[model samples]
Target: MSKDAFAAAALALTAAAENGSNMCLSFLNALPVTHAAISTLGAPFGSETICASDSQAARLEELQIDFGAGPCWDALRTRAPVVDADLSEPTESAWSLLREAIRDTGILSLYSFPLAIGELNVGALDLYATTRAALNLPLIARASALADLAATPVARQVIRRLPHLDTDDTNPATYSRREVHQATGMIIAQMRVNADDAQALLRAHAFTLGRPVREVAADVVARRIKFTRDDVVDRD
Candidate 1:
């Protein structure tokens, strides 16, 4: 892509960001990618997709959520970008379901960029291509920048829905516990651990019980689940 194209794409993404849409779409759409999707990763809520350019992108996003593992998950967990220039080349392994589905669709390339806010990991922007090809350095750099710009709007949405996360509200009963951020914070206070560790514990229990993290978090807020220095207590 030319410098002029890059500049125009960036401007489009900025407009999308201000309106709280898929801010990185224009930038990646300018590339060879066939489809793209942005998803927010969180406890209880799991992977909430923000936007997708088309149906293909939407299906892949749903696949990532159902499988609970993919390049998006890897990027979010590592706080870095993940590039799979060819999904068919890798015969087998982790995220097998996602790999197989991608193979079936004949989309051979995948890229994921993490939308990070300092030490906090908010989400990822995923790209899919019908052919096997790597993104050029300039495109990758621009996409990364777009991912960074995207974080602010995504974070704002999270905060707006879960106001208790920003405030020092102690009463859990006052607000809705349908989201996991509040429960995650409650765990942090109870265990005196960092946000990441608190989220890990919450996910651990949810995975163990084959339940959604948000449901598990609601239990925590309702005093059905308690966290201590040693372990987590379950009233149910």
Candidate 2:
């Protein structure tokens, strides 16, 4: 891509993060790779969210969350470069399921790069390739730099989107736990019930479903799905 195109994509990423959508995620509609995500953050801290350059990469991340193993996990755990080369070629026999899935999708290589926001381990950006060498060092360096630049908008978006918690409050509880509270509040407002009553209902639903309260809250807020007396914790 041209430098101008790179700049425009980066700007779009910033805007998306500011919108409380996702942090530094952009979908490269056309590329040799299947997908990519950038973490607009540093290490020793928590990530704002997940960002992807394409949908396939996004699916991989989601699958990783479900499977608990993949480039995303390796990237976050080691903070180093991960390469799958090709799903048909595996380093070991253990990742059979992952390998099969990638093969079905025609994704040949994978890379997940860590994004740090100051001292925090903000999050990771993932990339999918049709070949092993799709990401050169220069591209990795550029993506890393872009992730570093995206932190500002991510922070701004967090504050703007969640007003109940103090914006300056670095308490992850406010960010995570309070996310549950915020969702509960929205549900309460919608149902025209008391805050305590709403909290009880949501908490009960989350516990029954075996999901984290914050995650439940997010579902409620996004309206991607709904909750009910018989609702179980929905794991994605």
Best by TM-score: 1
Error of 2 at 58 (Å): 3.6
Query: With candidate 2 superimposed using the best TM-score fit, by how many Å does residue 87's alpha carbon deviate from the native?
Result: 3.1
| lDDT measured at residue 234 in model 1 versus the true structure, 0 to 100 | 42
In model 1, what are the clashing residue pairs, if there are any?
Answer: 44-213, 44-214
Which number leads on lDDT?
1
The weakest ten consecutive residues by lDDT in model 2 span: 40-49
Distance from true location, Cα of 79 in model 2, Å: 2.7
Model 1 lDDT tens row, 84-117: 8777786556887778787798788888998755
Q: Any idea what lDDT model 2 has?
A: 0.55
For candidate 2, report its TM-score: 0.52
lDDT of each: 0.72, 0.55
